[model samples]
Target: MSVAKKLASQTAVYGVSSIVGRVLTYLLVPIYTGAFAAAEYGVVTGLYAYVSFLNVVFTYGMETTYFRFANRLGTDRRELYDRVLSLLLVSTAGLTALLMLLARPLLGLLEIPPGHEQYAVWVALILGLDALTAIPFARLRLENKARKFATIKLVGIVANVALNLFFIVLCPAVASGKWLPALQPLVTHLYDPTVGVGYVFLSNLFASALTLLLLWRELLDFRFRLNLAVLRPLLGYAYPLMLMGLAGMVNETLDRILLPKWLPDNFYPGQSSLTAVGIYGACYKLSIFMSLVIQAFRYAAEPFFFAQSTEKNSPATFAMILKWFTLCCAIIFVGISLNVEDFGQLFLRRPEYLQGLVVVPILLLANLFLGVYYNLSVWFKLTDRTYYGTYIGAGGAVLTIVLNFLLIPLLGYLGCAIATLACYFTMAILCWRLGERHFPVPYPALRLGLWLLLASGLVGLGWWVQLDGWWARHAWHAGLTVAFLVALYVVERPRTAAPLVVR
Candidate 1:
């Protein structure tokens, strides 16, 4: 198979799982919004944002390090696997224990509600389990076990979704004697209505635990010994990645975390900061289509890039990948941004969440840029200049923080949406500029820029053109979306020409 074909096949498998699984989980938005108040859902949003941040800390970049070293010419892949797992096991244990021990203080620091002390412990366990399983999953990717990876991911997502429905929907009906009066006694034993939004965390914890259980055989091959020969280079490489991951999380998720704390009371006139957070968080799910694609591509691309680093045509392959990736993202950006209202109405059961729909397109565009940045970041990873990722990510994080702080007071979450777009767009540009100097790829800069410009114009047109009837509005927007794809196909039609290369 050609390199592109191989990557595409791998991405297809991963993307199917990611898209299917996330869409399944994404379906719970209506359950959450319908059953809980915005303030209640805000807790779910806030807690998971911390999980994203701590997940980086708990794993500390070993997954990527494992992939990098394992693919080296003469490395003992099994030994590397054991050593990496051992390292993660030890560190994860200590960190999880520390988190458990300091749960009360951490809760206070996070400004969590008084009675939800159990949330801290549940979150710590979830984090630790996820961290422990990180290497096993990474190993599967390195070995091209995409099917197994997808299976495990789907299983976990299914379990999570099932649990969510049970706790959030089924149990409530049973307890209320509305749907299944016969199950009331059994449901009461299992479900506490007061737990409320806590079920979201509980569902995740159970899913992570189940995933770890499924990966037990992968862990059985491990022996708890850390060789400094491996440890030195791995840590040397990984610490910077960890830093980059942390900063990247800041750019990605810190807005959700800070939006509640930083925004003034009554900023939205009768809406609390937490309520604003809930609404923004729910609307933010509207952008998951972009994140889903980026994540699936990252799964296939990272290991593929490293393994192909020595190939003569790898730069061309990388450039081709970015061009097509950005085009796909641009299409998605326009398609969803144009239909943001429909998505909001369909997914967000409550009307309050519709208020934050304004941020969805901005966020979709932001995530599209983020995917481009991921493709551009291969240069640093391939060249073993991972520290450059740290610098770029840290710069983006600073920009995100400063922008969020400055704009939250003025424009609320729209400011956050703006900051996210600016941060990721800047990072993508910076990565491209730096990559040209060190590991040049003949990226189709002009073509990709023009496509994005056209996509943006369509989105603007969708916004500006108001229709009296809903069907007319949608028909017009759908036609515009189709025109985007048709135009790209015409412009990018295949030709008998040599592929562009940097050298």
Candidate 2:
């Protein structure tokens, strides 16, 4: 099979796992909105934003490190595995303890009330468990064990979703004497309706713990070797990736973090700023259409690019891949933007949560740029100039934070979306500029720009112009979507990429 075909097959398999798991887990959004108020949901969003940063912290870019070292690139696979596993075990334990100890101070840093201490501790535990498993998961990726990887991931998602239902839905029903009278008091103690978002955290904690248990095979299959010599170089390589990961998290999640504080309390008067956050968080899920696609692509692309780094004409290959990826992302952006309103059956159980839907298109576009940036990022990763990634990501993160600070007070959550779009756009541009100097990929910037503008304009037109009839308006927008797809085929059909064989 051709390399591109292999990549597609891998992406599809990974997508089945990630996209399916995400879709299943995604279904819980409505259940959550139904169970919790906007403010409660907002608090959940804020805590998870902090968790995203901590995940970056505890994992410390070891996934990328493992991939870089354990593969054909840097070190003996078994030796690299043991080195990373040993480091992770020590670090995970240390960080988990420290985070729990500093939970209150950490929450204070996040501008969260210290009363949310238990939540902070839970976040600490989740990140540590997840960090512990990072190298194991990367091992699966390196060995081309995509199916096994997907199974484990899907299993975790299933467990989390099941626990969520039991805690939020079934337990509530049982406690209320609506389903199981025998289990009423027990469930009443276990399930706190007013505790609201805590259940979401609890469910995740249990699921993560279970996943660690399931990963015992990878953890225990080989004896962990303590090689300080191997450790020093690995750290040297990974530290930059850690910085890049942290900065990337800020770019991706700072908006959710800042939205709560900067969005005024007056918007919902009696409620805290979390109400706006809840609305924004729920609306952001709409952009997961693009995020899921980007994630699945990354799952395949990261390994693909690493393996391909030694291949002949790889730059051209990366360039071709970027074009297709960009086109795919543009399709997703258009798909979500056109269907944002009608996707109500799949989104927002509470009508009040729909207030922030306008952010959907902006975020979809933002994620498109993010996907492109990821593709462009291959230059630094392959060249061992990962510090460049840190520079790029840090710049984007700073821009995201500053823009959110300035705009949130003025425009509410809309400002957050705008900031995100601008941040990713700037990052993509910078990555392209720097990448050209080091590992030039002949990415079709003009074509990509035209497609994005065309799709955005079509969607934007539909959004701005309120057609009188639902059927007529949707049909018109739907036609525009078809036109976009048709145009994509017409432009690219005649130009077939040569079968890629680098090894």
Candidate 3:
């Protein structure tokens, strides 16, 4: 019970940043959807999709490697940190430079507008800064410095949001002499209207740089060690994780990348492929609510899991965690998917963006499965059979690529949503099965499946029963959601009567 409370408390602290910062950042979705055309927003979407893949390459699984080795007996914690950060610094430098050097050609390949060549360069810098800070942030997690981590994360996000509003909203208004006429001259000198959506990337770059600056103490502590004895083991363990991460990013972001290429012209009837990409991308932000929950849990759970690896009761504790995690995610899946119309109208400012709302529920459920997979993945990591993760992730990535290729032209972005769902569902099931053999946990699979089924059934019921008036329809959905909570309480109430512990 105490352990669970500790995990929950840490999750809450991390949630302060992940949930709050994401919601703050999520607000920008509306601004972008309203401010730019779907095609223009597609540029932002496509570029960031590429950045996700590059991010995996930049850090190359060193963060988790640091946590693993740092906790191992007889390992020099300071030496581990130094070697990890040193490798990351050297790799990030070379990768960012190479990215910048090939920026134009890369943009050309992606079919980015010619004048927007700077996007690639800005993206490289952002990735480099983020990669460099990964170890510092990991150290904070390992040290149980949740408050500091949350504070730094929130500060960076606030800065990003403020800058975005400044460059994208305030500057445009001022330069046009609509608001702050007195500042028009200065704004005109500073803001380039031609930059347009480029300001989004610029705001992020500035924010990343700010984040790196704030982690100066961590950077200053680096002692620049090149001990191959220490590094060889770290790299050996991490290279597989890097492969896993690259493949995971493919499962996560490749749809956005492929949708622009594989989506046939005029599939949406009068909308270009890029416009479809923008619409899909905007609606995809709807999944961030669930993603934020998973991310917060992960921020707390990863290190917590490592620390608990030696406990006799760890497997049972993990099983208990998975049960509750799935239940919460299931509720979120239903709540968000059922009210997706309201959410779409609220966050997606333009009507065209709403055309992709059909994908929201699909995506929300997909993310739920992804979260489950994250929980099941502890076995491989703890057992040091991380190659299993590489295999599982690669299988999912291959599936994502194939499904996107085959379905994008036919079903449009709906195909991408389906592919994501299938990929995650398969991965979660596979991980559970594989974990049973190596690191058996008595997971309540049947109960968890039933919970999901009940949630899915309620959503299906909400969709079936048509009611007039938006408020009345929402009332029915609320009633259904409440019923699920009631059922959940009835089932888990007795379990809570005693502290969950190993006998």
lDDT values for all models? 0.92, 0.85, 0.91
C-alpha RMSD values across all candidates: 1.4, 2.6, 1.7
Candidate 3 residue lDDT tens string, 230-339? 68988999999999999999999999988878877778889988899899999999999999999999999999999999999998889889988998999899889888
Candidate 3 Cα misplacement greater than 4 A, ranges: 498-503
Tens digits of lDDT, candidate 2, 1-503:
97888999999989998899999989999998898888788878888888888888887877887777765544678877887889888888999999899888867755666467888888888988888888888888888899988888989999999999998899888977889799987886777776667888888999898888888899888686777785897788888999999999898888887776677768656656777888888888888889999998898889888988988978888878888888888888888788888775567998888777888999999999999999999999889999999999999999999999899888988999999999999999999999989987777787778888998898888788777887988888888889989998877777764422222
* Superposed Cα deviation of residue 404, candidate 3 (Å): 1.3
Q: Stretches of candidate 2 above 4 Å error?
A: 72-74, 109-115, 185-194, 268-271, 497-503
Compute each candidate's TM-score over C-alphas. 0.98, 0.95, 0.98
- lDDT of predicted model 2: 0.85
Candidate 1, residues 1-503, lDDT tens digits: the string is 98999999999999989999999999999999999989889888888888899999999999889988998889999888988898888899999999998888767755776878899899999999999999999999998999999999999999999999999999998888899799888998999988888889899999999999999879887788877775998999999999999999999999998898789878999888889999999999999999999999999999999988999989888888998899899999999999999999999998888999999999999999999999999999989999999999999999999999999988999999999999999999999999999998999887788889999999999899888798899899999999998997777765314543322
Model 3: how far residue 15 lies from native, Å? 0.7
| Ten-residue stretch with the least lDDT total in model 1 | 494-503
Which pairs of residues collide in candidate 2? Answer: none
By TM-score, how accurate is candidate 1? Answer: 0.98
